[model samples]
Target: MKILCGSAGWTDKTLIACKRFYPADCRTAEARLRFYASQFPLVEVDSSYYGMPSAANSALWVDRTPADFTFDIKAFRLLTGHQTVRESLPKDIAMAIPETGKKNLYYRDVPAEVLDELWRSYREALEPLRNAGKLGAVLFQFAPWLMCGPKGNAHVEECADRMQEYTVAVEFRNESWLNDRHAFDTLELLRRRKLVHVIIDAPETVTNRAHTLWQVTNPELAFVRLHGRDAEKWNATGAPTAAGRFDYDYSDNELAQISGPIRDVSRRTAKTHVIFNNCREDQGQRNARTLMKILGR
Candidate 1:
């Protein structure tokens, strides 16, 4: 299942051809979804960012996406350490969990019990997609604070453990984890756990490392995210979310480099999914169209 093309589902102002995923395009949510589905066979929903969608929303998504199309959803922020909260107790109890309002390995501190509850609850949300055969990989884009080391490896182990418990593909952030110089223990760990690595494509900069997410040998589902090649923005702030510098596009050379990696991984796999997050404007979308045209997908 090599994914020739795909775009991040966000209601951006930039208009793109082929198709558009309205992740938060709730302005005309259903219509946006339908519109995109009409043009593309797949969509990567950012719904997990805001936490699992309600049952009604899930039902709506199931009803909207055609049987042949697909939806790749990232894991919720809560499940990962991208967000933090007090792990509030029930309305009746008022005070039970941590008052420090701890996070998780990515952010605030959280009790194991809270994490267990959160993971189980969110896992349930994917049931509809699973049942419909539309469930894509669960990308767990861990927070930047999750710097790699002994601690990072521990986090990886924990995440892998959870994914195995749930039986899903996963993705990772933090350059340390992707560094080729680093040991392959982590990569092997993912392989053993049967977790899919989320290959990242961003400009080579101090903040961005050249990482290949093809650890999962099968490549049944290759996940690639083009975070844009804004080297200056990344190098200057050491942050990927600095300002939007939509001044560059994937040159032939750059795309050539990427196509190789995709081909390398896909050569042995069944399917691949390439997403363009350089979507500050229509950069990612444009690249996707170009790749589609070039690859004749």
Candidate 2:
């Protein structure tokens, strides 16, 4: 089994501001990516979730990283039924939308043609990475309101159909998806669609948060995201940034405890990707390195 450990994204503001992970000379974007690639074999593209990615940028990413390095891109907010800013859409697409009074865009608000265009553009943007064998998976992280019901299931199926050509991974934020009543059916649904189940390590104190389940829905790959155990901030209202929401570091003991389950999941799948999402001041990078060492990778 192959195990790849990495952070959610390489370019977090706090991660850079800390001045601990990167060398002093590595200041530019190119230099930072090259330096990060030298340390970790994989990375998750978190920025892509906020807005559409350009093909040119993806091509540049292909050039900067090592041949074996892989990138798991987070699905765009619009694609995953989240409330997206109107400006986040491509300028052309934004202009095309019939001037609704609303400032935000949701999946239900778009016309079929516009939806098709958005999906096409998103897939095209990642072509460079896919062609180069560096695209790991397109992660579809559903919103907390997306419950375990017919509507949510249909949406998941739609997303899977849209990205049928690529490796798809599903991360459910709502607890209902894996609750005592729906856990079996949810896993079965993912298994039927061949969607890689994304195991989350988050603050379990929140009632809405999904429980951490170690099962693998797709035998091809398994994904794990550690969001730290900061229960207080997990559901804190009016947080300034995601870093503030996911702000906790893993101790050596914590990493060692999770390493065993990660290894077990890796054994079941052909490959496993473990990503740290704690973006406070190089915590993810430091924790990822520690986990890698513990796993003897």
Candidate 3:
């Protein structure tokens, strides 16, 4: 698996605010990125949460990295949140909730127009990344409530279509996808389309755990995220505390636990990607380095 680390060059506030991976001190983004690339070949940028970046920003990122280094960009929040459904919901569902509320379908049941607008916005935001050759897959990560169903498959298809402008990779939070034929069908469709499948790894015993790991069943590129195993507070409002708090480093033995599956997939796939989403202050940074050491990259 190609090891990729999370954000670096965080401030002290970011450290205390995040607490998981923050150091007492760190350097600038460019300096830290250069240092990191010297160890790992790729990075997964999670900072593009608000929207697409300006062209200048993407250029700056490219210039900072060596020609051989690469970056994986996460999709916009609007895409991740299923913002298209915010239209058309009844007034109760629409204005009934607060913007900051963690409601599943904030303003769902709205018209398809909202979805269309969202899809358009999604494309616009990804353009800069694509133009810079820094764009990876449009990580279509769904919330746990987004269970697998006919509707989801349609949306998945549409996601791939919308991604014609770039690479599209999907990650499922709902486990109903595990046994259902729909899951296999969806996987087959993704394989046929040559879109990447993002395998996820998280503490499965927790309430609403996202995924066990990025299942590298196919030979396409693999994208995996290791969200720490904070099984207790997973469902509470304070989840991000644990989510971005605990350290879940893979010991040398545990790294062996994953090597075979990765190699098995690599036997067929062109390239594989493993992302450490351990958002705890510096755990992601630390774990990423450990993974690179283990992988001898």
User: What C-alpha lDDT values do all the predictions have?
Assistant: 0.64, 0.93, 0.59
On lDDT, who's better, 1 or 2?
2
lDDT, candidate 1, 77-176, per-residue tens? 6556665343332232223345553343333355666667656666677778878887777777777667667876677678767766443555555667
- Cα lDDT of candidate 3 equals 0.59
Q: Candidate 3, residues 71-95: lDDT per residue as tens digits?
A: 7766655555455333433244345
Error of 2 at 112 (Å): 0.6
C-alpha displacement of 104 in model 3, angstroms? 9.6
Worst 10 residues of 2 by lDDT: 236-245
* Residues forming the 10-long window of minimal summed lDDT in candidate 3: 3-12
Candidate 1 off by > 4 Å: 13-27, 85-96, 101-108, 165-167, 208-210, 213-216, 235-248, 251-253
Determine the C-alpha RMSD for candidate 3 after optimal superposition of all C-alphas. 5.5
Query: What's the TM-score of every candidate structure?
Result: 0.80, 0.98, 0.75
- Write one digit per residue (lDDT tens) for candidate 2, span 1-297: 799999999988888899999999999999999999999999999999999988999999999999999999999999999998888999988877786788788899898999999999999999999999999999999988999999999999999899999999999998999989999999999999999999999887778688789999999999999999988888788877656778999999999999999999999999999999898899999999999989888
Ranking by TM-score: 2, 1, 3
True-structure RMSD, every candidate: 4.3, 0.9, 5.5
